[model samples]
Target: MAILPICIYGQPVLHTLAEVVTEFDKELHRLIADMHETTVAAPGVGLAAPQIGIGKRIFVWNYADQDEAPAIGVAINPELWIIPPEPGQADPEHEAEGCLSFPGERFELRRSAAAKLRAQDADGKWFEISATGWFARIMQHEYDHLNGYIYVDRLTGYAHNEAMRIKRKRNWGKPGLSWTPGIDSLEG
Candidate 1:
């Protein structure tokens, strides 16, 4: 397996919505393998195709609790169904997160506590899974990339403040602060 170069935040490919994989061909499999290799090399829990300059709807993630060994797998053409937060439902707490695309820049982001997802496996077999906690957060983050969304878009309040801090550090000494308007705002 090869380690692909992850496209950074300013790369145009990252902002483009990925195309669904119509055929589970050798190339698709190879891309998944390369993505896994790259993510593992970066010591990241998840990665998406667009992050690696591929405009395909695919992602790889592994989320095993402390006790169990991590289980890594691929998702192709994934779909998500978010359960509505109940009345007075507590917002999910912020967690420090790092993207394969933005190495050495970690920030806090809040996401749903749980999510229901449907996607195909490496063999193009369909499956549905419900995830919560860290697993859920990782899945949601990677899935967002397929739809041209990044983790920074989900931050709120103090979480947004923390993200700005990290962003400034990452872009220290740069001419001007580069920001994505809608994404930079804390309001969701």
Candidate 2:
């Protein structure tokens, strides 16, 4: 398995909705393996096929305890539905997030603390799941990739401006720098 070069922002492949994988063949297995290797190499919790320029409806994520190694798995032709934040679950705060595509850059973005998703396993077996906490965020973020959405789009108000500023600065040769948007600017 090899670590694939991730497609960064502005890549046309990333903006296109991924095609569904209909066959669970050796090639599919190999792609999942390569994706797992790539995700670990990048030290990310999850990854999607579009990030690697495959444009397939596939993603992998694991939320096992930090002490335990990640359980690498794949979702083939997955579907996701966002669950509305319930009473007393309002205002999920922003979390600092990084993407393999956006190397050396990070942003503060708010995401749902919970989600409901359904997908097939590598063997084409169906599964339904509900996730919460950081795992939920990871699922939602990666799921967005399948739909041609990036984490930058999840940011609101000043956070969006801050991410753009840092993105520009990095393109202009700024490195090893971190950006933090003012919390007061976040919308509820």
Candidate 3:
């Protein structure tokens, strides 16, 4: 498997809605393998197909720090629903999230405390999974990518302003992008 070049914040693909994965074949398998390798190399908790310049609904997530963390592999054509917090419950945690597409950047954002996911495997097998805490947050972030949104899109108020400031400084908010894998960004 090869590490694909991550399409940065300026890439149009990251903003465009991804197409559904219809055909499961050798090419799809290779892409999934490459994505997993790239995720590990980037040392990221998750990644989506659009980040690699492919406008397809797929993502991989691995909470590698945990001893029993399960590999997310390729979640194709995934659908997600955020679980609402209980009544009288405190607000969900707001935490800083980093993206490989936006190297050296992190934005504090709030998301649901839990989520349920429905997706197909690389071989087109359907499955459902539930996540909470950090894993839930990561899945939400990656799901946004499938719907043509980056994590920055979720920022608000001061966080939004700060993110925009960084984007402007790094020249990362433009529309076109191209990069060589591993050579483009030290972290990516």
Candidate 4:
């Protein structure tokens, strides 16, 4: 396993739809292993294939901060169904999150309280899960990555404006940018 460089926001691959995983072989396994390593190094709860500049529908999550977290594993070509979020002002303390792509930035965005996920493993085995609380939040975040969206892209109101200001100030949201976890001072 190796730590892969994480692509930043505005990388073409992050904006482009990822291809479905058809052949579950050595390459897929290696990529998943690499992603796991990179996620751990980045110290992120999850990492998606596009974050590493790989345009494949795959992501790995390691969520251990909460009770009954999902097992750390790879989710490929996953489909997500969410319970609608209640309408209200976002609670930054409770709802704020970050992204590896938008390194060093955090924003408050409302998310579904619960979600149902159907996905496959690296070896092409199907699995289904119901995630709640922070695990569900992590799932929604990673799922958005597979669909060519960073967390900032989902922000609105003051949070959205703040994120955009930061993007402009940092000169991010452009192509040809990447960072290595455990090596770069940047954090997300």
| Local error of candidate 3 at residue 136 (angstroms) | 0.5
Candidate 2's C-alpha runs over 4 A off are: 66-70, 85-94, 172-188
* lDDT of every model, 2 decimals: 0.72, 0.72, 0.81, 0.89
Candidate 2 lDDT over residue span 1-188, tens digit each? 77776766667667789998998988888889888877776668898998888889999975574322235567778777776544332243457777766655566666667777789988999987777777777878898899988888667687678777766765522322222122112121
Shift in Å, residue 87, candidate 1: 9.2
1-188, model 3: which lDDT tens digit per residue? 99878887878899999999999999999988889888887778888999999999999987754322365555899999996645442343457788888777777676787888889998999988787878888889899999999988877777789888887877777766545456665442
TM-score sort, best first: 4, 3, 2, 1
Prediction 4 TM-score vs. true: 0.95
Please state the error at residue 4 of candidate 3 in Å. 1.0
Poorly placed runs, candidate 3 (over 4 Å): 65-69, 84-94, 178-181, 186-188
Best by TM-score: 4
10 residues in a row with least lDDT, candidate 3:
85-94
TM-score of 1: 0.77
Best lDDT goes to which candidate? 4
Candidate 4 residue lDDT tens string, 85-116: 98997787999899999988888889999998
Clashing pairs in 1: none
How far residue 125's Cα lies from its native spot in candidate 4, in Å, is 0.6
Clash tally, candidates in order: 0, 0, 0, 1
In model 2, the Cα lDDT at residue 123 comes to 90
Candidate 1 per-residue lDDT, tens place, 1-188, comes to 78666666656667779998998888888888888877776668898998877889999986566222237878889998776534442334456777765555556665677787789998899988788777777878899899887776566676667666765666532322222212342221
